[model samples]
Target chain A: MSAITLFGILDVLGTFVFGLSGAMVAIRRQLDIFGILVLAAATGVAGGIVRDLLLGDTPPAVFSTLRPLSAVCAAAVCAFFFGALIDRLKRPVMLFDAIGLGVFAVAGCEKALAHGLAAPGAILLGVITAIGGGMLRDMMATEVPRVLREEVYALAALAGAAIYVIALRLGLTETIAASAGVLLAVALRIASVRFGWQLPRAPGS
Target chain B: MSAITLFGILDVLGTFVFGLSGAMVAIRRQLDIFGILVLAAATGVAGGIVRDLLLGDTPPAVFSTLRPLSAVCAAAVCAFFFGALIDRLKRPVMLFDAIGLGVFAVAGCEKALAHGLAAPGAILLGVITAIGGGMLRDMMATEVPRVLREEVYALAALAGAAIYVIALRLGLTETIAASAGVLLAVALRIASVRFGWQLPRAPGS
Candidate 1:
């Protein structure tokens, strides 16, 4: 597949999983249907929209195309109908989330580089794209973002972004570099969750 | 003054007050110097950046020019040094915030219309620009956004935007319309705060 096609697939997959996660959160918060759908769309497209905006891409893909909207709608509808079942399958949902995070990080990094951003900007945008959606969801739900308070979620994204940039610098093919970044991010995130790894807190209570 | 110069003054003033508000919040949360500065900049420029992005204006003003950054820095430094005094001057800070809200709402609406957005889109963007920064700040502080939960804050912005749009449609001069919008919003917000006006809560506790 062309690099564009590969990234497109990753983008849709990430949007779907992130939308599902957002819908689940809305359900838990007892929001009405409209709120659920809004949250789902917001969480699914916010990162990509922000990234596109930073790159000066007008009428972001989410606005110019139908696929992302359809993906978000599908996820929201699925979660609305099967929230209980998904709640019982917490491990599966978390695994999907990890995968989504990794894909988004790689796709975002690639896009930033394609837009001629320097390494630092590219890497930062990559991490932001990975974590931005979930951060928005948590913020709307009035909670501290999980990435800021616990786990190594953002660290995992950072590692993936850094790896992608370095691999590209070392002349790796796009596909191979992307795969390496995604795999490492997913593995690191899952490992952190499973092993209860967390960054240190402030010096005192 | 030209409309552009008028809006520029409002934008800078709004950025400064919003940055001050954000810095004060960071101080209250006991964040260190870097954290305070980050919050100040984020709160100051986030709304404008989002507005510019949606309008397809890349390398947002905050990035392309030094005025907004300087305003944010000034506010942050001021708050860092005088947080205690500012804390005691809560009423004055709130007054400044109301002014910021009014100016941002009008400026955002004007920009949206200038970009050829329909009435609904323009009004929505106006409200978003007015409340977006504060919502971000509240979210960063791990609290429900004040606009979502209490007071007549967002309503005031909405009213201002509506007035601006209507006046424009009525062929009012740009200055008159803008002045009317800003004055109404500021008056409404200040009145609401002084009189403890609040939107009704959900049916039950």
Candidate 2:
């Protein structure tokens, strides 16, 4: 498959996983069916929408194409029907979330670079695209975003995007760069969770 | 002044007031200077940015123009320096918030209409623009958005935007439609607060 085709496939996969995560959150919060769908869609597509908006990419892909939207809806419906089963698979969900983060980070960085954003801009947008959805989801749930308080979540995304940009700058192949970025992000995320690593907090409460 | 010019002026004023509200919230949360400024800017321009993005307006006005950015900065700086004084004037702050809501709602609706959005789309965008910033602010502060739980806040914005669209459809002049919308929104918001009016909540907490 072409690079663009691969990216598109992974993006849909990421959307499905993120949508599942959102659906679980809504179920945990006792939200109604409509609320589950809303959260699912928001967590699945919000980040990409923001990234596209920043790049002046009109009518963001999610709005223009059905694949991503379909993925989200399918995931939400699956979770709704299998809430108890999914609830018991917390570790698997986290694994999927980590993979989604990595995929999104690499995808976001590549798109930014394709749009001629400078290195710093590309990296920032990549991180934003990777983390924005979860942030929005947490906000909607009235919680401080996990990116702000969790185990190196945003930092892993930043590292992933930065590595991808650096590898490209150093004349690496696009495939190599993308793979390196995604692998690093997923590994770091999983390691952080396993080891309970955390960024330091400010002094006092 | 032309309708466009008037809308521009009110938009900046709305940005300033919303920025002040954000700054005050940051101060109340004991955030540092950088945090206050970040919240201020987010509260000031996020709504407009979202509206512009959804309408496919590239390089959102806040990024392309200095007026809105400068207004947010000025509000943040003022709030940082005069926090004690501003804190004592909660009623005034709320009044300004209500005015900002009306102005933003009208501006968003006009922009959406200019971009060829239909009535429902325009009204939805308008309400989103009016409530978006504060919703973001509360989210960043880890609070349930006041619009979701407060006294008829989003309803007022919805009513305002709907009125604007209806008036325009009825062949009212732009100025008349905008004025009616703003007046009704501000009046409704203030009255809601004054009378402790609230939308009914879901049962059993």
Error of 2 at B88 (Å): 2.4
Q: Write the per-residue lDDT of candidate 2 for residues B1-205, one digit (tens) a residue.
A: 9877877787888899999999999999999998999999999999998888788886688888899889999999999999999989989888888989999998898888887766766776788789889878988898756665567687788789999999988999989999899989999999999999755321222
Tens digits of per-residue lDDT, candidate 1, A130-158, equal 88888788888877655555477877887
TM-score of chain B of each: 0.96, 0.96
Docking class of 1: incorrect
TM-score result, candidate 1: 0.61
What TM-score against the true fold does each predicted structure earn?
A: 0.61, 0.61
Residue A119 shift from truth in candidate 2, angstroms: 20
Global CA lDDT of candidate 1, please? 0.84
Q: Model 2: how large is the Cα RMSD against the reference? A: 6.8
Instruction: Record all residue pairs in model 1 with backbone atoms less than 3 Å apart, i.e. clashing.
Output: none
State in Å the error of residue A143, model 1.
3.2
